[model samples]
Target: MNEDLTHLTREELIAEVVKLRKGIRAHRDSTMHELCWHHPQLWNLLPEKTIPEIAVPAWPQFIRGCLRYRESLDTQLPDAPRVKKEFNDPDSPSNI
Candidate 1:
């Protein structure tokens, strides 16, 4: 991952910085629901192309994990505004 950048022109170095900033901005602007999904596009921005093996928890365990995460958010950002809008996932069977 430690590629020597000495060969790159000033313009090239600036272009790299610009590209990195754009990727960071995209991640920073993700919504609450969007944050729940995996972001391979963001990972692709890095020099490493290899995908790391991901371990998924079972449904019951995953739900418990989600609950704990939500609880942590409540503790961390207690003053954050709550959204009452229902999340309608168009592709979900329940929505159908």
Candidate 2:
């Protein structure tokens, strides 16, 4: 699915840029839960069909990684507004 950029008209190039920007913005705006899910659709933006093998950590390590990610946000966006937890129930499958 390689696109020949050489053949694209000025308008076509602009349209492609706009399309890619929208996709990038959507990924940028994703929340915590969305971040944990696989994003094949985002990968589809490229011209490849191959999927790389993913390595998932064990539960304890995974939770620790999540905690570190939150800690990083504190450092990176210290003054950012906070959102109330949407998945706080301990027994819930979607708890974050």
Candidate 3:
């Protein structure tokens, strides 16, 4: 991986961030789908609410918690795992 972002202009960096956010949303959607598929009873328990209503509200806090956990790990080991592109393919069997 090219560990250099210095070459990217500010606009380019912002664009990359947007792209990453989209990928994250897609991954989250796929995971939620798999969860619902595996646990139909859980879906029934929340019959009145759509999936977004059930999950979207918690996304921000969940992301913050993840960042905090990663930051703590990074303090111990400077070379922490960066978010790489994974789980974006909706047709993957693991996603289903």
lDDT of 1 by residue, 9-38 (tens): 899889988998999999888766675778
TM-score of each: 0.75, 0.70, 0.31
Q: Predictions ranked by lDDT, top down?
A: 1, 2, 3
Model 1 regions lying over 4 Å from their true place: 88-96
TM-score of model number 2:
0.70
> For model 3, how does the per-residue alpha-carbon lDDT over 5-39 read when each residue is reduced to its tens digit?
67889998898777766655654555322422334
Tell me the whole-model lDDT of each prediction, alpha carbons only.
0.77, 0.77, 0.54
Cα lDDT, model 2, residue 92: 48
Each model's total of backbone clashes: 0, 0, 0
As for TM-score, the candidate ahead, 2 or 3, is 2
Runs in model 3 with CA error above 4 Å? 31-96
CA displacement after TM-score superposition, residue 28 of candidate 3 (Å) = 0.7
Q: Compare the candidates by TM-score and give the number of the best one.
A: 1
lDDT of 2: 0.77
